[model samples]
Target: MVMEFPLLEGLSPVERREFIAACTPRRFRRRDIVCHEGDPGDCVHLITGGRLVVRVTTPLGHTATLTILGPGDMFGEQALLSPDARRTATIVAVTDATTLTLNRSQLERLRLQHPQVERFLTTSLAAQVRRLSASVLEALYLPVETRVLRRLAHLARVYADGAGTPALINLTQEDLASMAGTTRATANKVLRELEDQGVVRLSRGAVTVLDPAWLATRAR
Candidate 1:
């Protein structure tokens, strides 16, 4: 999991080992609520296994999926960087998951010993901003089918299992709708069209991408 993280990329072998040794490993079961929105940000989590869904709910109970994070991704950094920061989103385990954590106390030590962590936080925060900006643009002008297809392609590219398993996105129609900024019924209709075109297959609580090439074209 540390292999691809830019923060650790510049470290020497000895330094990398020492940095990893400082982390505390934590595990969560499937369906676990790893952290709740508005909770005190006490730890930064680096994902080592499984997947997580970042979600937010408004006061009126309207929920949306902000993003789906897979292994090698990290979260809670924003909280760790700012004093008195509360979690901006709730994170739930999509499968049994493992993350290495650094509490605020330990982070202080890391700050002094390994300054590269600051670069990681800054880079990650910037990427999040760019993604949110693109999301706003998509919401403003993209049509429903185009948005749905694009969301699927994005997930497949980011979260595809490198193992021999199918490059399928294991999310429900409702979750897809939430991520695509569309209604569930509209998502269903568009998915059925894609299904007819042999682009995807709909199963219980999941949608399997059949032709990513074609789906990518629709996204364009």
Candidate 2:
């Protein structure tokens, strides 16, 4: 898994080995605050195992789930390029999580040693900007229900271990509502209708999609 990251794609076997050796392993329990928003971006993290929930808490203490991250994913990269930049969001462990963490000083040293790594970071950051731009446009224009399903479908692609429906999402309806940018009552009503259509099943704090393929059709 260490060698599987996109950021390491340009590295040779020896380079990849050396790069992995430089990383420090860190672990967190569920709900642990991996990094808080507004903190200085000290390092970049690669998720080696388990799930992470990325979010932002507003001044009013409203938490909005930005995205769910899983194994093979990377975050905290914006810091590598801009060390003094404030963290854009808060990262919490949704499940027991393990990550390979590399601090900015180490990254700078590597950037000087490995030109390919620097190039990869530049390219990856550009791609991220494009993606975020599109997401912002979607959030501005998509209907409330469509936004919710779109988020669910995206989460399934990232975190689902099996094919098709009953994709387990370990998030409360409040979390879903926050991600969808809608009120809890509206999210509940929409989810109930989806449940009636056999698209989703609501449990205590989890949601199970019975037909993600069908859900995707409607999400579009």
lDDT of 1 at 62: 81
- Per-residue CA lDDT of candidate 1, range 1-220, in tens? 5685555666666556666778899999999999999999988788888889999996789888977887777788776677898998999998899999877777678668877656555776787788779889999988877898888887776566766344677888899889898889998999899889887778898877777767777788
Task: In candidate 2, list every pair of residues with a backbone clash.
Answer: 166-209
Per-residue lDDT of candidate 2, residues 43-138 (tens digit): 889889889998998779877887888887888888877757788899999999999988878877776787566765776687689879978988
Question: How high is the lDDT of residue 70 in model 1?
Answer: 74
Provide TM-scores for the models.
Answer: 0.87, 0.87
Model 2, 96: alpha-carbon shift in Å? Answer: 0.3
